[model samples]
Target: MHAPMPLISTMVGGLVLAFILGMLAHRVKISPLVGYLAAGIIVGPFTPGYVADLSLAPQLAELGVIMLMFGVGLHFSINDLLAVKHIAIPGAILQIAAATLLGFCLGQMLGWSLITGILFGLCLSTASTVVLLRAMEERQLITTKKGKIAIGWLVVEDLVMVLALVLFPVITEMLSKEGVSPTEILYSLIITLTKVIAFIAFMLIIGKRVIPWLLIRAARTDSDELFTLAVLAISIGIAFGAVELFDVSFALGAFFAGVILNGTEFSHRATNNTLPLRDAFAVLFFVSVGMLFNPAVILESPFALIGTLFIILLGKSIIAYGLVRFFKHSKETALTVSISLAQIGEFAFILAGLGLALGIADSKLHNLVLAGAILSISINPFLFTIADKFALSRLRKNTTLTDTTSKETAKPIDKQQPMMPFSDHIVIVGYGIIGQKLLSELNDANEEVVIVDHGKEKVRLLKMEGHHVILGDGISEEVLTLSGIAKAKWLFITLDNPYETAQIMQMTKSLASHVKIVTYGSHLDEIEYLYDQGAYEVIEVKKDIAITMASKVIPSL
Candidate 1:
């Protein structure tokens, strides 16, 4: 294979593997990440198929990292990160410290070097944003106070992880060289900080001023490919400069580029186009990381592996839960935030790479930690189930360790919550005929009703009709918050999906335990599930339709 061709070949092979395995994973009810990891292992050097030459792949994968971080930055406004810093910064630090300490202890017990131990801990210290976001989306938790706080914490963690990546290399380069002194370390630190500060200042002061103008010019041209390429160029260019000029990691540059572009009006389009590219490369990156796993070594070090897993999954969960509690989040909110952030993610790989470059991590150690990371990501969803059960059990016994101090911390809305008598009441989850009929009935009754729909046209139509409507994902807590679920006396889930209704019901129960919940579903099983989730009444639409038809026929007869 030719130089760049081998890289292309590996990328193609990895993406195909990811797509196929990802579909299979979905069919089997597992995370697509597990499939991606499995694909990497199958096509890795240890397996029989086309071995992806990772040396070339990792370099390309760096593009993926840049784009991924860029996307993260674009969606994440600094205001949000700053607002939640209280929980995010402390939660991240404590979680990292706990995981690192546990890894060091496990490393000593396994007779590994202190460096290897630290590497293991570093890998475990980070959580996968991709996985966490997907999980939060699935659970309809993404729009909650808990979700916002959790993601904000991840943001801070990524920033800290970036800084650590920069520092590790400089320190290692100096220490590994001959005649290194304390003064050299100080100088290296100063030089690194200067580079970082200068790079950030340039991005904020310079990039921000220039990128908007550049994007507007690109948009005027109306060339999607050019615009896309422009986005990529800016991202890669900044990242490269950071690495070459400031001695910062390319990831930091990519992040800064994102932060810069985040201020621009063209951010949404930039992200939309870059997402496909990001997904393709990110899959390859995950595959490449999986290729480093030496299963034999991991199996041999069973005690260490098991111990590390506990620390990453259990210990980190505890730390996050405690921090959330200390921050005065509710029991449910604490559990929710903790469960979402229990797995290691992209920064773990970055740290592992840094450790390897610093000679702090050997092949065996890297492989061991990488393998464990994949395992954690794979099992994260299942672990959430366990977490929910544990929380429920604790809640049942009224022994939840929750943060009850922050009265300002918003709680998720609950159905069945008490409400003032005769308050305007409307519960709209969709805008279809069923919802329209319900709305009409409420209007005739002279009650206040709120419409929740993500459909743009429906929201517009509802607004034109003088109906109170909020446009957003109905399943999202933010959407519910906007809908004033906490104040509503009645909730009508007219959405067709019973699972979504169940989530809304559960989340509503946390915020308002006395509001009435009425839901409509097509299936009896779904209706039953909705009922179990605290629905005061679940009407099977199909059954009701049949009953109405029979009543009309009997009357005619």
Candidate 2:
């Protein structure tokens, strides 16, 4: 009988344990990353269980890294990046330097060599892309100014790490030699930089044109399977090719691939198609990180592990916060950026592994970095919660202060008059095509309507057009209150997302039981569920469209 395949066993074991633990972690109201990491530990060599093929797990994790970076690239906005560059570039560089210095100081305390200390410092300097993005996305901060600054800061860090990875080996090799000429070292650095510049130039100049052309062609086939295949092929193939040909990291290659497709017509579709794979692989990436961690390090080098965590969670965060504050950014922005960067991830692993292979770092150092990564990633979300509470409290204090000042400065009136709230008005949750049409009809009928939307540009335009608008998620209780949902006669949700519409209906019902909720469902299955959720009317979109079209044809006949 044939023995079990290691690849199948590892994949199955990793994914199964990850799902179970991830659900448990979610149930406990913590990040699922903690669960994924715990799953890795259970099946890891350090634990007394059926250990996975460590080698194969990392290779799989690498694919996850590629996919994660590709997703980042897909959402990457050049204008957003440019908008925050004044702060991002300087803040990132200074924060990295400060973190690196902290790590190096720790290394010196540990009696490590100069080069080893620098390498260790470099590993601790950069934040994890996966962790930061997930945190930002979950909090719905991806479209905010603070989020743009954080993402831009991350892009700068990634670029610096890419250059560091290139120069690392060359510097190590030079230090290994005696009497190496400055000219030779400079020449080597120049050559490495040239290769990187060339790869970027080629991707931007040629890959941009050719990759989009290929995607368009694949899309023209009118087959979703083919389109998805083309997307995956482009991401993985370009990443693999970049490593082999240009000597760049897979993350960079896949990132540029996603960037090339970012603004294309099918970019959103491409992102949706690859999301599952990206999420799966990203979990694997975290698990692989967990496997690298040895719990024994907690006992053997307890202080060192503590120090590493300090650098990752505390030292680096303080530096980032200071840099952002120094740059004249708001306290909220500074807190968000600093806390978001309080974790080291993929690049740290890559650097640690490289150092170990080069005999520059020992297994102890490697395990310390891994332990630091696992702990930092798990604790990051909690830090964000604390930061958010603090920011909210500060906001409340400032708002109260401003209100008191305005009250004292105002001229005394004969009697204080209360502002009237909108009542007997219609609340529109979205401003899409359907929403626009409904608004037009309502306007013609001379009905009062209040608009609630999350899009900045849409809200600005609505306000400019002299419409009553509230800028926030429709399902938010605060947003609904601001829209006067409690007094509104009707709530119309024209959002394309059925789940969000259902949520809005529930929220509206809770706030204003008498308010009628009218929404649309894309599928027949959703209509009953929506109605059960307290929707007064659920228009089955496809059925309604067919009926309307048939009416037009029959009338013509």
Candidate 3:
């Protein structure tokens, strides 16, 4: 139990140092990302200072990644992903292939085995999602067309790495004296794919409904504490669950969790609520990445380190840029995408660790990856600033896919459709299962209904059913006005995301204070906050469930 103190110490100590340096980095007009990395180095084993617990820092760093990816998933959209699919999907595949070939050649020259070479190449291929996201978010480029392309491209890299992690062992077994068959490798790949598919399906179908429902229940309790806990629970639980049960990467799991939520009304709220936690731990993640660096690699193998750096920083960037351009995007878009991919991160360390454990990689190779990650991540922040100064607004304005730029502002829908003026109607903010249920009940009661949803599929279905539907973000004032909130008799907020729920609540009351406001809370602690936010009625979901369940179970009493 006492051993855990070191873990706590590492977290607290790492944050303190990171904060100080991060402030300094800001004062110097550089990205705080540089300062975070520097802080990690100062506390890392490579430097001559108070070293943190290396083992413990990584586990905490994982939490940071889980939160960060969840935040990304919050603002992400399926449409954004599809827009870049042409460039991102094939671009990432070929980029990884090219990088691996480069690494393989370098390993051959270094006299390492084919397996080691492949692993080496594999590490070089994928850019650090953490690094890329932090850089993109710093400049507020994540929701832009180019940002989506980079994000989609990174997703491909993550999926490939997951596949590689599954296959590494089989290949290692073959290379061993007790050789394995090709059949074994094939079978392993199949099993890995099966797990990956199962996880994705589960998240999209089951988790989508379950996670949001749980959060809605949590929100109804009106407990700010519980609502926040519920958000962390959903994000961290799904992320860790993916790794432990499905044997996938934690970031991939969390990223998908956020993406799944993105399809729901709760996305913006989830992103806003999780931001502080994500930013704090994300800093820790950078620090942890820095902790792995061994400065000795520079002196011992300057040429080798330079070669590795060249492959990661220059080679990958050019390949990514060329691929984006091949897909017919403007040079500005191509270069923006390329510069983001220039750095490698968390996934590289994971691969290196596995290779070292399998005896396919030596300590020297591990050091190279670590050193390369530190250098790229530290310098990549400046590279992004340069890209911004060079490209700035031109990149966004000049994309070949013009719709990709404009449509990102809102879900591109046909404007020819007439707005149905819903009067004396029940205006609902979300169109999830609860909202749908309430919509049905209100219809059964012969009440006029106006439903607002961010989901195109739901809007389509609602329109087909002859219901008044507004297909825009609930957070938007224009969307709210379209929903006729001021004229509506009753406003029902049924989004599972408490943050979004609270936001909409404030928006609704501000728009129509005289209109009756009824909303649900996911936690016991949320009731007061909801009241403060102008809710006329705040129903705590869990308490209601317990009361209803108790009434049925102990009626004799």
Candidate 4:
């Protein structure tokens, strides 16, 4: 136990440090994980007296991970999962197994225990939700088919991580008991499996049926705080119940609770309301992760640090690229999806926690994992940009049937069909430069293009030019349906708000998977997120166009 007064002061100080560091990283266009890791180094044994109460930090961090997982679960609807189920589950399992084997081999070479090696591999399998999700939003690929698979893949990993969490403690407990045998282990496994099955069935089937009714009833009271509290209560309550009654992880329950509410009409409202809470607690989670690093281990074994970083970056990328391509996705799709999964995530910290508690990991190994996670996460966005460049080069070189581009596959529009139903058309969500360029190119090529803009004047102008236009915000479901988005062949989101674009794209993907989507965004980092959201193509307008012009201009001079 920690001294209360000192603990509180430590926590407050740690938070302040984390905030400042995060702000600096963001301002300098780096991942916040870099800031968090730097904070950890500064507050570690090497630095001055600002070190957080390590004992208390873990507890608070647990709460943060729990809430974070709960929020993840809430975002995952059955429909959303089902839409990308084929790739998500199998792809994740295969990736996990492959990573474990590789990690085991690497550990053997490093002279570590097999169990420790396996734990390290498991840690590598978990992709950072914060990093990947942020990247997805930036690229506006959140509605593409590739995006759906990426998110679904993450969802599967989240489930696996939670199960691992539950199993670790139980296995440790059994190992300590008298007459521990294969038979006893098998019995325990069966019992645990049964409980998990029951818990999932209750949450998805029973809870799904019950939760929306409760939310609706609460909403009728017209109290915003009440509604918000009820949302938290349900999330926290079900999560806690799973831990207490079913012997499961709180993250799993919270996630399933969100899945239940996903079917409701008020899900958007729920997401809006809960986002503030998610952001606050999420900060604590990152801060705690930052506070765990030991500079001594890193200094003692720079080789190990380098080796771990290599495995995190190169190992994951190779596996992701292979798996995504094996699923018959395009090279560009495969590359973006692969890059998104290249880093270890928040779940690694959770797994490390389990390992520490069970004494499966030594301080050196724990610090190594923490350091690797931080470094890998920090460079992830930059890595995505590199991946995209490689993918684009590959796309340009490939002339096979697998090559999917506007010029190669899409049919030209017929002059006779001027009033073609918006069905089987690409819906352009904005009329900005990228949107206009895409519209013009697609139009010239004879592909069906229907434009939607909230600017009434823009709509009128498009109409005057004999282009089909819908006047409304693309973020709204009513506007989407009215613009014939449900029937359209692709969704082209050219909006400014990365978050809104992601949400819209996700919803659009849910409605139609065959309808491939291609969108544009302001940042290269967001390309992965756009891929995860279900985009078939994510155009990084700033990087690609500017770089193209720069090359031409430089060469001419």
Specify the highest-TM-score model's number: 2
Instruction: State which candidate, 1 or 2, has the greater TM-score.
Output: 2
Candidate 4: which stretches are off by over 4 Å? 1-4, 44-46, 177-179, 391-557
Candidate achieving the largest lDDT:
2
Residue 203: error of model 4 in Å?
Answer: 2.4
**Candidate 2: count of backbone clashes, pairs at least 3 residues apart or interchain:** 0
Arranged by TM-score, best first? 2, 1, 4, 3
Question: What is the TM-score of candidate 4?
Answer: 0.72
Q: What is the per-residue lDDT of model 2 for residues 253-366, given as tens digits with 9 covering 90 to 100? A: 888889888868889889988888888888887787677778898999999999999999999999998999999988888999999999998789878877876788887888
Q: Could you tell which candidate, 3 or 4, scores higher by lDDT?
A: 3
lDDT of 2 at 262: 89
lDDT, candidate 3, 1-557, per-residue tens: 45557877887878899999989987875557767877887888889968999887667666766776676667556575587788888999999999999989988888898889999999988887667876665544555577789988987787688678766775676558456677867776688778878999999889988988987887799886787788888878898899899986676688788888777666666676767878888888778867776778889999888999999889999988899988888786788899999988767877887787688889789889888876787788778767765652342232121121133433232222224444677888777788989998998999988887755578778766767777655655556666677787888888665666677777777877778888898766687888887888998998888888988978853
lDDT of 1 by residue, 23-76 (tens): 998887667887887787777887776888867646755766777777777776
The global C-alpha lDDT for each of the candidates, from Candidate 1 onward, is 0.75, 0.82, 0.77, 0.75
Question: TM-score of every model?
Answer: 0.73, 0.81, 0.65, 0.72
Candidate 4 lDDT over 295-364, as tens digits, reads: 7877798988887887788887788789888888777677777788878868888788778878877777
Which regions in candidate 2 have their CA more than 4 angstroms from the true location? 178-182, 394-557
